[model samples]
Target: MMHKPEFISPDWPAPANVKALQTTRAGGFSTGNYASLNLGDHVKDNPLHVAHNRQSLSPFLPTEPVWLQQVHGIRVIDASTSSCIETADASFSTRKEVVCVTMTADCLPVLLCDEAGSVVAAIHAGWRSLCDGVIEATVNAMPVEAAQLMAWLGPAIGPDAFEVGGEVRAQFIAQDAQAETAFRPQGDKWLGDLYTIARQRLNTLGIHQIYGGGRCTFNEPDTFFSFRRDGDTGRMATMIWLE
Candidate 1:
């Protein structure tokens, strides 16, 4: 029996022209641990199953999304002309049919668009990328002014569950002293709030309209796939396209 995929929309007041969806682990054709709707082709899941899972998402997309070979770096690609897999953490498109997509398990997925929906972008923001300026790179790549862009944060590892070592804490602190507020001492390690860090970065960029940061992938096993919780797991996708 085939189950339908579950998706979440941003709660912020977005323009009607903008459309976005966050895929859950509920539906598709992958079996076993990948067990349906596994959109990440790079993962070790069976290639056939991954293809089927990607096909399941086609009906909901305006066009085939420009999937990037995300390398946890700060590179942003222009999806309008990109052909091959680009080593970028984010992608933006001004055309309506060129959907921007990112796959993640615990890492933050951010969808962005202008108020008029003239452009859209999808960013994969893990701690390493965030510290390296993934959010800044995406914001810079956007065609709209920072103030005119609205952002929606998708499921990620929450602060309470995202424990890290001293090196992780120092990485951000070295960039900005105020980043210390996003971390708290957990024994000899620390718990980092990726959402907060992302927000701060956006705020610094003059992007104030933000939403959807309450979900935690690591804790919500039934609804999402968490790499930290399940070592070999499928990936949920966060996608955005103009209607």
Candidate 2:
């Protein structure tokens, strides 16, 4: 029997038809640094295990998720009409059962849906993508107003663990001075709070109903895979779809 992959259900009050799931580094056939439940096929994990890991999610999902070749950019695709493995950082869908998914290790994975449950999106928000406005791009692609949208941030490298050089911080501050508040000086580098930066971006877009941020992949090795902490590691998938 296949072990059921452990999932973290977002606690946000999304409408009944908007479904989402966050995978952890548990319950799969992967081994070594990949450990188990490593869904990312690009990370050098055994292709068969990666395939099995994704297959384990089949019973829970409405359909096979529209996976992306994330380049940490601002591209957002319509999952309902996209081809397989589109090179994009985010994807959203209005059609029912068209699952949109983003894989992440230390980088943040954000799931979004409107209050009416008419649309859904999954974003891969690494610092570069977030600073470059991936969230904005995803929001723009959705048919609903930002005010009607709610977001749930999945496990990511926390503020204390996500150390970055000054240039990375500068890029964010260049976009919006408010981004400065999301970082704290740590010696010559800065500890960035991805959750804070995500919230700031969401709030600016009129999406104030945000939830789920404290979980840290770097801090919880038993539960998540952190590329920063483990140079060679697995990736977790975050999925969302409208029923």
Candidate 3:
């Protein structure tokens, strides 16, 4: 028998046919710090356990998601194709059931789809990727206009728990001065709001119909994985497909 992981479905204004879900850190065979359901093969979680966990998840998805080798940079791939462009930080699909996915521990996971439900994308938006324009790159790649799109943010480190250096804050501020407001001073460091930053990035691209924030990975030990909270932890997957 297999355990069905408890997951969250985004309640955005997406079209009735677009489907998306975010997995929690539950329902798997891994042990120790990974404890269960670690989807990221790049992590030190046992390969067999990760494989089993991924296989178990198949029943819940349109297809096995096109897992990416995220470099925290702005590279978006056409996941509907069978090409092996492995070094992308985001992926999109115009074809049905080609589940585009991104994995994260503390970095923000963002899913986007147009109102027509013709396209869907998953993004890995760490501070570095956010500042480097991953959101903009993804929106640019979509076939629809930005205003026709909706986005959903998944679990990540909250502002109260995500402390960053001055250099990190400066980089985002350099991109858009309004990014300055997303950071609060923490001595020489800053407390960054990953959700707010991601929202602001979407807003800049004209994607205002956003949803699914406020779930903090660092604070919610039972539900999420937080690299900032635990040095060795599992990764959660956020997936989207056009039905």
- Our tally of clashes for model 2 stands at 0
Which residue pairs in model 2 clash with each other? none
Q: Please write out the lDDT profile of model 1 over residues 1-243, one tens digit for every residue.
A: 755777887787888888888999888788777867889898889998898888888888888888899899999988988988888899998887888999999999999988888999999999999998999888898878999998999999999999999999999989877799999998998999999998898888998998989899999988889999988989999998888
User: What are the runs in model 3 whose C-alpha is more than 4 Å off?
Assistant: none
Ranking by lDDT: 2, 3, 1
lDDT of each prediction vs. the true structure?
A: 0.89, 0.95, 0.90
Candidate 1, 228: how far from true, in Å?
A: 0.6
lDDT of 2 at 47: 99
Could you give me the TM-score of model 3 versus the true structure?
A: 0.97
| Candidate 3 residue pairs that clash | none
Q: Give the CA lDDT, 0 to 100, for residue 186 in model 3.
A: 84
> Whose TM-score is higher: candidate 1's or candidate 2's?
2
- How does candidate 1 score on lDDT? 0.89
Candidate 2 off by > 4 Å: none
Residue 117's lDDT within candidate 2 is 90
Per residue, candidate 3 scores C-alpha lDDT tens digits across 92-146 of 9899989999999999999999878899999999889989999999999988899
